[model samples]
Target chain A: MALGTDYAQQDCSLARALEVVGERWSMLIVRDAFYGVRRFNDFLAHLDIPRAVLTGRLRSLVAAGVLDKEPYQQSPVRYGYGLTSAGRELWLPIYALARWGERHASDGGARTVFSHATCGTRLDIVGSCPTCCVLVAPEDVMMRPGPGALTELRQDPVSRALGRPHRLLAPIEPLSETVGEQAAEPVG
Target chain B: MALGTDYAQQDCSLARALEVVGERWSMLIVRDAFYGVRRFNDFLAHLDIPRAVLTGRLRSLVAAGVLDKEPYQQSPVRYGYGLTSAGRELWLPIYALARWGERHASDGGARTVFSHATCGTRLDIVGSCPTCCVLVAPEDVMMRPGPGALTELRQDPVSRALGRPHRLLAPIEPLSETVGEQAAEPVG
Candidate 1:
């Protein structure tokens, strides 16, 4: 979907995705929502993001269907932000990024780690196995575009690039492992 | 570790990660590297990122250990970029964000989907078992901060405010199990 500025204009799915969440304070707000912070004041206090920018981002997110503005109380003051169903699903991205930082960019001794409640051990962000606990590989996975693909992808680039009958939900290859190998490994 | 900035600065790891990756086009550059775009000219052609900004971001990322500069060819044309182990790991964040966009922000038909190659079924990005296909939960997880944590975290405002001992990386909490319920899952 096109945003107001062409700065975010790109036909790529990732670019299309970034148009909404790629701004500076956008994901941070999402992070707070995960922390169960529903109040606007709490977001401001925790993030230290400028009020105007926070207001604008919150508005944009609300407009984009990522947040819902609701009244938390009445009388003197009443209001807060809550993640819509759409907004809450962002957990993967946030966790993935945090796990990445925890592993690659971290200073070696992690101050925190993510434990898998089921497995009862800290899970590797990139490769968590529900069956056997080991790192998985790309050939181990494939992808079909979700329900959110654009017409341009179905008709143009994907069709021209891959020459397959485009089922937006069809399984394509997992390029991460193949391309990632040359790039390096454990991309968490 | 301190970057010479005041320890009182924002102590959010996501923010610090953003401080590095959140710059315009940095993630895109990493994305391009995944696509096998190595030369500066290739990055210029692919991203349309301003040369000065690209140069600066590349230099900074190199300095920060994400990218390694190597001589691909000599005789006047002597530079190319590649992912160090550090850079390769950035895929998690990019994938995470893209997944978020697909689920929350993308219009109908706007998102991409993933499937496990072994199962030939859609993969849940959050906290699913790769083998048994079981979903993981928040109480099942734990958090120990990573190496990149700010020393400021031990200081007054941040330390006191965020004084919780455990930094939990739980499976995003589930909301209602409605059709779009995945969209509302919260992570912390």
Candidate 2:
């Protein structure tokens, strides 16, 4: 992808941030991680990316300290990837961009809605709770599919599992082994 | 850069946002726009990007409604690109990402410091003023070169002009026509 030139000769902090997370599939993977899709199989099922690409993104994220890869099961050495503190800090930028898209880019309305988990009030454009008058932390935010979500476009088990309301950063249970295997095929 | 595949099958708002501004030099252009870089020659001088790439990015941003190109001079039909309301909405995400970079990516401290223009208090990590106890809008924020700024690396007139504190979104004067012609040469 010629990602190496992501920010050539730019001495700005934004350029540095982009250098780490600006790759094609990188931010989506981080988004999935925030959605609690920890395991490789879950990320593979939820995102339409090649396995090698996903692996490479995950490796880069881990190396950059955005995600931590740790053994979840030792029998065959399965690892789970989760957001680090640095990664959790990305929630604001991610949410801000998503809200901007919902306002400007989408005719389908909000595909997903984020709210203050405690008060159940939808977050403002900047990820703040209007009712509480404070910025909602990602951990304190809950997400649910909104009316604009295209359910028909997604059939993977992870998508189905995400239909219900979920808190950001809470681990998602793996889909059944049968469903996982069936959805393992990568889509271009 | 194979940027074509950035949002291949992604149906999320973040993906939509990235699709528009995720190219190699797009966000930096947007950042420069926020810093009052309206003239083409000023953008060319401030950003170390190829002239063709900068032109392409500016055209795309204008098409995407993030920027508006307007005639600033009638004699030569010269136009300046300014951020639209939708583009100004990007301040939160841009500031958030830059703050994150300053926190985690840079060892040289903040290259630039953002402050509340009204009270002159530096903004918090979330771009809110601690003294004002409110979120500072982009226009109300001021930026100044910080101790860690690498002024030596940039000799562009825009860089020199930015050395003094300036309010975000205030128009910056272009270099003299002769200097503009001299600095028009693309730098690698």
lDDT of 1 by residue, A1-188 (tens): 22322443332345655666667778778766654556676667666667998899899889888888888668966677877777766656665776565455544333234344334344456545545575432223222222222223222221222222222112222321143423433322
Give the clashing pairs for model 2.
none
Q: By lDDT, who's the top model here?
A: 2
**Which regions of candidate 1 deviate over 4 angstroms?**
A1-8, A116-120, A126-188, B1-8, B107-188
Per residue, candidate 2 scores C-alpha lDDT tens digits across A32-143 of 9899888998888789788998999899899989999988789998889999999999998899888887788776889899999999999987788999998898999999
Please count the clashing residue pairs in each candidate, in the order shown. Answer: 30, 0
Tens-digit lDDT string for candidate 1 (B48-161)? 667997898899789878888988667886788887777866755665565565555454543334333334344456534356565433222222222323323222221221
Q: Which residue window of length 10 is worst by lDDT in model 1 chain A?
A: A160-169
- All predictions: root-mean-square deviation over Cα? 23.1, 5.1
Per-model interface RMSD values are: 14.0, 1.3
